[model samples]
Target: MKVLIIEDEKPAAKRLERLLLSYDDSIEVVAKLDSVKSVIDWFQTGKMLDLVFMDIQLADGLSFEVFDHVSITAPIIFTTAYDEYALKAFKVNSVAYLLKPVDDEDLSDAFAKLNTLKQAPETVNVTAVNSMDQIAAAMQMLTRQYKNRFVVKTGEHIRSIAVDEILFFFSREKATFCTLDQGKNYLLDYTLQQLIDMLDPTKFFQINRRFIISLRSVKDIISYSNSRLKIVLDHFSEQDVIVSRERVNEFKAWLDQ
Candidate 1:
């Protein structure tokens, strides 16, 4: 099988190639390209490829933009760092979606899916243009719905809290809670993972396993031990909030954006 890999990160691209070869030594990687422009240019050359492993976010822009400029027919398996909601969107068109740091088992599963699709004549004949249209429709669906407010029950009365009024969300004792800007905390029914899909990425970020903080909630940032940074939020002094070491780079990139 001839494969083309489009990934911005060099290390991740290399790791994917290693996994592919380990799975099947006869599999040949034709080329590795990064960025939307590079991918478009490569596809225009009319190279013969059996499959493609693509990253959703490239250096220049979203890899979906590549389809706008060129038509691709090879089966694609998307590798992305996006949460499950975004993965659900990609499933509308791609052969399969794999989360980042692609596991060997997941890779095998994706290949199995591809083989099954190839065996079905009706499924194998689906054009790439139709897939592109479905991708656009899925993205529109994802962007149109974002939770604007939450309804909470306080005693016998129920009140709605706007997302702007909340400072942060945290998990303790397997229960979730949200703190307000005015020094009030409320028990929430949704878990931290659930909130990741509901909340907008620009406003809320999961700094660590225990905390998902808003952009306005950051009052101070102090460098902590072992390359981690301490986060200080208003009205939330229950514990020290620290960005985990693994997420440090992504946290910094999010802040810069």
Candidate 2:
């Protein structure tokens, strides 16, 4: 099978190429392109491709913009560091959504699903129509407001904390707590996952399963063991904050943005 890899990170693109080749020696990676502009230009060539492995957020813009300029009939397996784009990804020719640092098992499962779809060509048209509908819905969802503040009760006193004033949110013993700049901790009734969807992504990032840190909260970033990163936050020393290895790349990208 001839495949196209659209990823901004060269190391990641190379790693994915190696994984694809190792999975099936017969598979040939025809091209590797980064950025939305390059991908749109490549697709305009009218080259034949059996499959495509694409990244949602490219260097220039979102990969979804490519669909606006060209038509791609080949099945795509989206590889990304963020899960927020999962719903929008399926609105295209996406066959699977694999999180960054994709492993062999996930690749195998994606291919397995692709094979099944190949056997049932009758559903392709239906999928295409549904994909367009979902894209519209996903766009509408993006316009919704993100949480700007939180209300917390402290000993019969109610105080509203601006989201920006909170340094970070962490989960401990099955409860979520946000720490303020003045070193005050407030218990919140939302899970880490829920906070991720409600908080503005530009301001907050869920570095791991336990912590959702704001950009203003970052004090220092140090390299950690196993390609992970240790984050230092102000007034919070209850536990060490580490960025998961899989999320390191995305974390850096978020910081740069």
Number of the top-ranking candidate, with TM-score as the measure: 1
Q: Give the per-residue lDDT digits (tens) of candidate 1, residues 67-136.
A: 7788888888888887654555557557788889998999999999888777885866523523766778
| Model 2 pairs whose backbones collide | none
Writing each residue's lDDT as its tens digit, candidate 2 over 1-257 gives 99999999999999999999999999999999999999989989999988889887789877777777887777788888865533553545557778889999999999998888778888754235225555456534545588999999899899999998989999999999999989899999899999998987778899999999988788999999999999999888778899999999999988886
TM-score of each: 0.59, 0.57
Model 2 lowest lDDT segment of ten: 124-133
lDDT of 1: 0.85
Go through the candidates in order and give the clash count of each: 0, 0
Candidate 1 lDDT for residue 257: 59
After superposition, the stretches of candidate 1 with alpha carbons farther than 4 Å from their true spots are 123-130, 140-257
